[model samples]
Target: MFTIQQIDGAHAKVKTGADFPKYIQEIKELGVTAFDFLVSNGVEVYYGEEPFKTNSPAKYDPLNINENLNAQQFAKELKEHQDGKTDFPYFVKMCAINGIASWKVDLEEYTCTYFDLEGEEVLQEEIPGE
Candidate 1:
């Protein structure tokens, strides 16, 4: 299992979405199999093998998740962020505006799925390897 400190150290290196693959690879190496991140407040629950799990407190103040699902705008912002044109905070604000409630990363599957406020998957993308 991974500690919050270790995860935080790994996460601190992520300045933008372009840095995500490296951060994911680092934490996955630390035994994090999966993690769900709440977009509203930055809370994250990390899972390891069976019976091993941990979580981190919210890193920021809560943001109201929009009810309308603006997939097109979200995709556009996501692409820009992924291209290294936006910082993490900016990307998160974009997510809130576009109605993303949370996101889950499956390290084994190399995928990240975003969900709406209703818990429906809005987008699922392959996570690029470092």
Candidate 2:
């Protein structure tokens, strides 16, 4: 099961277990695009420091899975992307299809966080000078 919360006026957050694909399909059934739904639902951002560039091929790659692919197939594809076995272009397409704009994995906590398009965290190192 999955839970969705509104983060703010323009964002929403989602929490789920291993059944992320089911929740994604649910969101799609709500008449909202997966990207918009995930973004509005506040999916956690991953690799915030190195945001996907607007002109990157990955940003525009199309999802190529078979139309008849099942939830398991979706999950498998997403897992492969998460494992870094896929290229950025493929990852981008996967993200678009899955509505996972940003994500972060916490090894210590054994948790994953997903954020919306606007939820990406900007990393800033503190400087000595004020």
- Which candidate number would show the highest TM-score if scored against the true structure? 1
Candidate 2 stretches greater than 4 Å from native: 1-73, 82-85, 115-130
Which candidate number has the best lDDT?
1
State TM-scores per candidate.
0.98, 0.29
Candidate 2, 4-118: lDDT as tens digits: 3221211222232333343444433333222322222233322212232111113232333223323444467756754546754455456555444555433223334544345
**CA-only RMSD, every prediction:** 0.8, 16.8
Error of model 1, residue 39, in angstroms: 0.6
Tens digits of per-residue lDDT, candidate 1, 1-130, equal 6799999999999998899999999999999999999999999999999989998999999999999999999999999999999999999889999999999999999999999999999999999994
Note the Cα lDDT for every prediction shown: 0.95, 0.36
Task: Show model 1 residue runs off by greater than 4 Å.
Answer: none
Work out how many backbone clashes candidate 1 has.
Answer: 0
Residue 43 CA displacement from its true place in model 1, Å: 0.2
